[model samples]
Target: MSFESEESKKLGGIKLSTLTQRLAYAGIKEQKAALSRKATDNNIKQIQAAIMLQFGKLPAPAKIWANVRHKDFTRQVRNFMWKSIHSAHRIGTFWKHIPECEDRGICQFCNEPEDLEHIVLKCRRPGQKEIWALAKELWLKKHPSWPVLSLGSILGCGLTTFRNNNGQPLVGASRLYRILISESLFMIWKIRNNSVIKREGAAVPAHEIHNKWLYAINLRLNFDRALTNHAKFGKQNSIKTPLVLQTWSSTLMEEDKLPENWIRAPRVLVGTEQQSSHHPSPPPGRRGRNR
Candidate 1:
């Protein structure tokens, strides 16, 4: 039985279903196009100024918006960055007008107005500090020094550039920085939300926080490795094996012991200096049994 009304289907020689689908697609396309125009808001201006202060070059507002959709970012992290740049998260003053919800706008730990910056950067939450510390330790392996991380710098991490004394671009280091910054920021926000909503403001333990951060990093490492398969992601989309190696070279567990091409290596973990000493990394294609 046909569900479409004959009159509706014949109106423009197109079925009602097809017309509805076209209209819906057009609406979605319009919304996406609006994002570029929205880039002129104060939030983007602040990010532009922050990027300029940190990198010594002002990226256009459009570039900042484009960076939020960087191909390297996972879909969830990309959306979070987009919301952050738009200041769309219901934090800080979003609850000010709600009846009897004023306290929801304040951070219980710091007793200050709550916002994305406070959650990710300024809050003294256990997870916030430990996550960043772990990220810095990992980054220090890739570069000699770490950049001064501000809210703006963190958001504009996609535009971050790394260079050697010869003024050559360090592509691996830049990619690593973007991944670490975006993941750490998202982790902090998760911890904060869990504390405020689920645990009723209880603090997560420091050790647990560190473990969570490492897990997130290792998960990304595994995802990167999976994306390197030409059969899966194709040449254009797949991350080059060398780039992956360079991105994670110094940070893997028993990195020196691992083979040169370890893309297919099993149980490849990102480990700290202390942790690396306890667990030896296996060479590529070695399937060993543990007693």
Candidate 2:
């Protein structure tokens, strides 16, 4: 039977069923129209902005559905935004291992809704400051002019490429910035979990976290060096240049003071001689340095 006929029969002369069906359909139609109108208005505003800046403009209706034709651009924008907002998933199996908080189902470290923001930015656990400080340093290295606020803003800006006043792309140093941002956040989350779950009440030291970050940075720099060397010499067997290695190694050791044993390593002897003699050694007559 036709829908109209079925509705009429169900109403039994009152037509209540038909009326209800019509009302529901009308409500859906109105909602669609309202959303279309809102999109149309937004497009108009964007067009106006473009026209004022003499960059050409899209018609209101066309702009509203531009994603249909410009699928790649739309998808790239969507993915970039998604990654910027959700960068905490970089560490292998870190989030997966986070047990639900007993009280509010939150991650025990960050304690703010148990999501990316909480774990990286809002976590109040000890030694969290080091992760935040490292993140800030990375940001400043990439964007000297950017204002440092919460970790979320830092990651967002790092992941996104913005146009300057002159329409230049003010992005991070490289595409690898996304990976670095994710790794840093994941490292913080892992350290927090390790301290809370395995170590009981013992906190992960900030210096340890910094060392891990430096190691990751050094590994990436070395990989880059190897790739560049291979490209330049057209041979994988060719060793990386001492100059490039020296530059990267110095950068890795910039903030870290290596132990006496590390300082005396064969590789260290070939590099810079500016190594710090102070390696967290015990006080003159004391056992180990106080915790």
TM-scores for all predictions: 0.79, 0.43
| Per-residue lDDT over 1-291 for candidate 1, one digit per residue giving the tens place of the 0 to 100 score | 878668866534555556777776776677656753474376677778888887689999889988989877889999999988877788886688789999999998999999877888889867777687778878877787877788888888888888889989898898899899999999888888788888899987665666677888888999899989989889898888899998888778887888899999877888653233334533433321211
Clashes of each: 0, 1
Residue 245 C-alpha lDDT in model 1: 90
Cα-lDDT of candidate 1:
0.80
lDDT against the true structure, each candidate:
0.80, 0.45
- How well does model 2 score by local distance difference test? 0.45
Among all candidates shown, the one with the greatest lDDT: 1
Location of the lowest summed lDDT over 10 successive residues in candidate 2: 268-277
lDDT of 2 by residue, 1-291 (tens): 555654555433345545676776777678766755664454345334433333233234343233222221223344433443333233322344356524334545544455444555666775455655554455444444423344433333222334457977533232334435445555666676788678874776645666766565545455545544565667644434543333333223332464432322333321112213344522343421122
The per-residue C-alpha lDDT of model 2 at residue 182 equals 47
